[model samples]
Target: MKRLVFLLSALTAMSANAQGSKKIKEKDMPAFTQFTYTGNDRIYNDNPLKEGEFYTPVLQGCYPDPSITRKGNDYYLVNSSFAMVPGVPIFHSTDLVNWKQIGHVLDRPSQLKVEESRISGGIYAPDIKYNPNNDTFYMITTQIAGNMGNIVVKTQDPAKGWSDPVKLQFDGIDPSLFFDTDGKAYLVHNDAPPAGTEQYSGHRVIKMWDYDVKNDRVVPGSDRIIVNGGTDITQKPIWIEGPHLYKKDGRYYLMCAEGGTGDWHSEVIFVSDKPTGPFVPASNNPILTQRYFVKDRANKIDWTGHADLVDTPDGKYYAVFLGVRPNEKLRVNTGRETFMLPVDWSGQFPVFENGLVPLKAKIKMPKGATNQTGKNGFMPNGNFKFTDNFSDAKLDYRWIGMRNWRENFVVKGKNSVRINPLEANIKAKSPISGLFYRQQHATFTAETTLQYLPKSEKDLAGIVCYQSETFNYVLGLTKKGKDYYMVLERTEKGASKVIASEKINPGKSVKLKVAAQGDAYTFSYTADNSAYKNLGGTVSGDILSTDVAGGFTGSLIGLYATSGNDIQP
Candidate 1:
């Protein structure tokens, strides 16, 4: 009876603490809603046979290259923010599946280069870990624009404060920290060897060296090769990267993502007796991949792998990784998003049964987590209806801007959202006058019916698979003399490629639908939902990386209006 009373008191205190905060103002909210859906939610519910079922993207919209760590009962994750002013966005969760963005690690201009760096190249992967001895949380990141190998920062109280970033002399892309039981710290990195030398090691190799905690440097005498790419190479030209380490029982486990991070790549697990020695591959290599699941719709898109593992308070293990769902017809946008899976341990080794399987079914929330539902909801699952009458007092989290925004693009009146052409063309200097959200699930579809009023030859309006100004897939109506032309442009390759062009009459409203099943994408036009035809050309490869785009967010599916002259939609 005494223990029960104490438990009740504790709960009461937590409730009070949670209620202390007030709702953030509409303008003060983060630039992008972390997990807004760009497609139909039915795609994630299409698969019902997978074990443990499947959930929607927990952290969406440019929430790629995830690095997760657990400290006691709390779990923390940080993702690469790239050119966004605040470099790395940090999220915390009690349950491994549900996450909330708490703060950004680098909030100062000195830590991030937003003015000069392209949107997609500012920040790379970041690894988060807690140092128990010092009682501090440490974050390591790579500044692609600065061309610096890695940078480290720490905070004693993650909720309130963080230290300035300290540069480290390490030549690698994705850098992770492994704290051994003996209190020794080691740095594991994907070594990018000198170019054009066959003897030089590939990115797949995991190299380890003792790190000096006080000086924040790699110790000279502690360098050693831990895992080699030759043993677990993916069937792609790009080598493996993103190495994360964990130790269980008497064995050290190295789990890294393989494949070129495209359609054929995936995650692989290896084990060894020591931290710096030859590691043996698990019986089931590519332990977590969609390659073997031929019939799964989620596998249809290129499911390249990059993963981070974390354990729950109850001692259960989980892995968070990145995957993509491509649309062949509208193939310009290809930013990877986050996905979660449960990990089962057998004896000393960890196993993931549902390897590379897409989330096509509803999943029950873990014990103690809340499940909230709405059209543009806060929960991990659920679809957002992009169709807005613009009746609300303010824009919903479902909408994100394509570039640095201005007040001229949207005018919210009493009944609907009026989108005006801010620029002359889709590829113009002015902002793309539209609201967008990321493509969340692997097999969903997006449909938008738009009416275009082109004011000039440069005037156009329609839906786009947006990454950056250079990397996007656009299908819009452009004014040509007295008529309108339906045009398809592929910008993923940096240079725009006009894939398809057709003439049509202006002022007619047309319905556009973009469908995605795995890596396969199809774009269709219809006056009605029942009839459709395919557009040509498909986008794939590193061109899909966030490094190519300028947005701090992911690929967005939104309406855009542009013109050299004045036009409104």
Candidate 2:
């Protein structure tokens, strides 16, 4: 009963930050920080670590649905970029621990048309595999929003660019490419059976097709069902997706994720002698999961699945998969993150039972493993802290926009970035125009000084703590009925509600700030460039989390300017 009372108090405080003191309940009159952080957030490494340990999140932010390849000693990785322009991000590493973003597979506008794509509805999972026989790198993926169903793009040197996409006929999402020791190649994916019937909601079948290298397409009339509705059709293992085929010791192995991507999420495996399987499920399924990680533990790692396996040049096995760290009450704020785990085949089948936490791996450094640092020279971990004066003629490479390009609005000045408000408002579904950076940490303060005081009440320029078009919090200065007011607003499902507002005297500029603590955030502003004052009631970061926003991307902290008056004809 006490816990429930405190929770209600917390909710009251958060709502007050959104709806103002009048809506604030007397039970929560006191301003208190409700959320608690567990502290796994650190973006970069400060010192060189022993070979037994390495920094995680080889690639950070909304880079999900990862695909990896190894060419000789070099390792190449690509993650699904979704609606963001410059689609699939391609990364390179020598040891698979230290990765550098070499380029993006979908760099050309001609290759993909993501105009007005919902944040969640864009590119799906992608598979990056190398064919030594052809000396080429092949990438295949499903377009969630634009283009045809599934497409394959290739490149000889990925650093340069990739060829135009070649459409592949596959009825599924997570498309993967696998080459056999022999000349034969195969493509495996999750799709509804030919009968198009299912026992349960997540009952998707794994289908296989002969991939023709010569024609660069699936062989005509060669679709086969490898595993019928998961390990067993009756038990009905749900969401048996993200299949990766491997051949080892002359046995074909297929590994996949089961249980929808939530608390029940896990990795499972099957083995067969042929490329297409009469496969047998391992007795020990759910090879990787955090469900057993002690729910009440201090460090909580949950939602572990969507994995891709890779073998180092030295024949060592490792896996890169998506995992999440919930902030409070199992509400996730960081979105799904990339985590590394060892493939313990010595056990029954193969599994990483310890779950999502990064382990102290006892492995030799690959031939070309080198430590890479961010622009700030910090080592990589969970928290990525970034600050830019915007003095350069162009925006930093780290900042990304929605459907539009960041270059369109980011103009140069002496020491500041001058942004022209987009004709569209941020509340619109038509991808909002904002220059955003990933909110890598659960708790950090973001502050920006803006010089604009609106000539019209319609000018809205400020710092946005955003998840999607439907979910965001804005703290900026605007004119409310001829009075310059500092307003805090919460936008959910295209509706914007003012939480609090303070009428202030007009100045040359004002500094807006947001401090995140656990799942909650506090917004403040300073017109004098000093003496910050709280602007709104505390707000929940989970509101902007992918779990609430419904997307494959994470939360982004951005500088946005929208002419609320600028509506379409």
Candidate 3:
């Protein structure tokens, strides 16, 4: 099996490089730069990315609450695409570490409306920001359901499209975008100002408004409050939320992400002399933390904070934030990656030399990064192998769906992708013709290859492992009334059962397949392509985890369809 996965990835990179933090060695990993083939996506390189090192989820799976912004030598970043529908993802670094997904910011579905919203409820934390004297880029988000709160979108070319959402009446969740130093433009958020009153479970507050980019909105009365309760309102530090806004040397800092995000997530600081803030509280205040390394086994990296900070057009300072790594017993099925380091601003403030634990899976690259064309990082690039194989005609921009918006019902066949199964299934209410992409390796497998021929029983289709709409796992391909099975199904918490089945007969095609490794998921199938069959149990990738499918995205394996339910007993 590929030399037992290369001697079990070189004995787990020689037992994590004999216990120190900077290692990456499965033969200098990065999937060996090119020898062809990188199937189960191995490049978990335990550290070895040398010479000024580098390699850290520069942007890995479930990229959560990140929000970086740069514009000139290029930087971008923008995660937190809640109900997923091209909500807000956009990456494009020039080497503040490597990154490259370059597109997404509500890529239209009327620009801000997640078809009924559910799985972690629609786009919640976005920030982007780039107003080079009005060249414009702004993002600011939080739309748990249509335009009920913060929203603002723009683009001078967010990779070629964007601009439609502008509902910034603000109530808040995690919206940001600050441009002050004479250009004036603020938003910063966390919410609770419709005449204040929240004072408990992280009792909200860190506000600001005044936007109005030539009538784009948010400045009618100018809104207020810029720091309340976070940073010592007597340590009420609960869910103080991700609220970025920086500007050093001229002051006006204010970074957030307090206790609520798991294991008491952190990163807290404030400092104002203007940008509105009688703000102050940064004697290194939480400044950044691994929540006390939870148990500190040399820094365990528990749910660390939601940071932002950026600067590198020959400037240096870098941040990015959001962490999580637990694979088996500590359990986290990937759900929050994106972690970059560097930022010691000579200690006048910003720091991260182990900024209070967990930031060393190898880091360094940032003192005038030459923008390595090493083909957008985390390996497999030089030789390629992330796989799609439905034969492409356009759909390879990292597919996504679930809040529907795959360019008018997804059709692109000649090689395959004719999915028309739209009676809405996955147990309806929101699920529809899914078509995901983002399981970004912890070990991979994901298969597809169905041909379809069921006239009823809602003509289902196959292959999923998704993580929302009540957690998922499905295996699909049904017809019940005419007997054509291959189901497997799961769905936790919100409930749904069926574990295993097999009875197929549509022999023109059928591949299926699953196979994650750390949280388990196994399933298998095959018919026209020969030899495979092995479906039944082992589905617990923590029920599409976020602590059992609660959602912030990550775990969207792929391909789905459904029609079966018009009544035919």
Candidate 4:
């Protein structure tokens, strides 16, 4: 199996190399000396977090479709990566307030085959569940690319590693595994309506299957539709997805996200007597949503849905879901983020505490625990600064690659990191020689210092603010004739436009910086650590928004190098 995977990867790389993009020798590639990122969003910086209060959106920046599970005192959380290599980032928490990213569930090339897919085509809505019956953990998700449909992978401990994916025999998205106390397992997911029963656009149904745990497959004929058209079939609620099943107090409860994944997104609940049954919608219907809120609100957080629930050892319930914090212009460049709220499952159905109201920027810490944001290696929140000198051989898990991660391009030294230029540029849908970090704040600055002398006009290396293939900004040092120039290029709807350019004599070191103040962005560069000069005065960040880009991911700031440089100024 390992040999087969190697051959497949080699073939894919060969095919990508045949795209007529220029290649360069490894010795002449660019080496980045340092990279620094700082997040200073006004919402986080201005607001004072009182004692015992932490900022919401625990896991920020494009980490959408959150699914969480608890095993005794340990809590494990997983989020959708969507075509990024090493998909399904798994995080661990002991007190729910302080969380740390352990590792990715799909870490190797054999486990994830997404070398040729687009940035948003690989993994979607991964659901992680722990079954005490077998003392195992299962992660199930839909692979939208690579022709790998719904798949499942298991592990005895999440920190060690996960098994190779076991393809499930089912057709749907957002699949979740439910373990009943009776030793029976079940699977629930969002699927299309039955044959010829298609009603309207965005109409979807929730289906359940009797999962055979011994064989790791769904039973042959146990598929049944649990809910049709969301809360009410007659009202025609649309895009009912991200479903999960839970049993409490001798009753089965079904929860799903409804009304699409935009501002109208919401979470609804239903009840049934059996795992697969005639489920009835709860009177409260949408247990969580921000749809009713008026537009043009202050510090707005929108598109709240795709939730999962987990109970603590002491029986306290909490929910984790996805929401977006848009800029003042109502543009979402940070993408769908993960937020948490305590649940009021004390009733017949669960309700997200303050989930229905406008989301608050701060929340009180859970009982007996203090806020741990940015402390003890927990994922940082509010305003923070991160600097990487590339002194360690192992890269941080926050740095990711699109489609596939190539080992040849990255060379980590004692003080710097060199990237062998790839033929594939950022404009192509294929994998490029770039290591990306998601834009975690609405307003932040990313800068990198590199040593590079472009061999020709075909070579370039610098930083990229990438939303997708057609929506991004590339600021790099490229050569024209015999002079070196720093050029900033913008691609909107697949058309490239040169924003600004300036000729410079970068002697030994050149620093490039991309700063964003809400919707406005500026690109600046300095030579030999001299005074910075603005290459692009300021440009609107609308192009980096999902509303304008039409994708399922947030902006990724990357250390990029490519031999096939096409943008010129």
Clash number for candidate 1: 15
Indicate whether candidate 2 or candidate 4 has the larger TM-score.
4
The models' CA-based lDDT, in order, is 0.61, 0.70, 0.68, 0.88
Query: In candidate 2, which residue ranges exceed 4 Å CA deviation?
Result: 1-51, 346-348, 353-379, 382-384, 392-394, 412-415, 565-569
Tens digits of per-residue lDDT, candidate 4, 344-372, equal 88889997899989998888788887777
Better of 3 and 4 by lDDT: 4
Higher-ranked by lDDT: 1 or 3 = 3
Query: What RMSD value applies to candidate 2?
Result: 11.3
How are the candidates ranked when ordered by TM-score, highest leading? 4, 2, 1, 3
Residue lDDT tens for model 1, 414-453: 4434455543344443234556656665455776666555
Q: Model 4 off-target regions past 4 Å?
A: 1-27
Worst 10 residues of 2 by lDDT: 28-37
lDDT of 2 at 363: 31
Q: Number of the top candidate by lDDT?
A: 4
Q: Residue 245 error for model 1, in Å?
A: 1.4
How far in Å is the alpha carbon of 557 misplaced in model 1?
3.9
**Model 4 weakest lDDT span, ten residues long:** 12-21
Highest TM-score, which number?
4
Question: For model 4, what is the alpha-carbon lDDT of residue 382?
Answer: 82
Instruction: Assess every candidate by TM-score.
Output: 0.67, 0.85, 0.35, 0.95
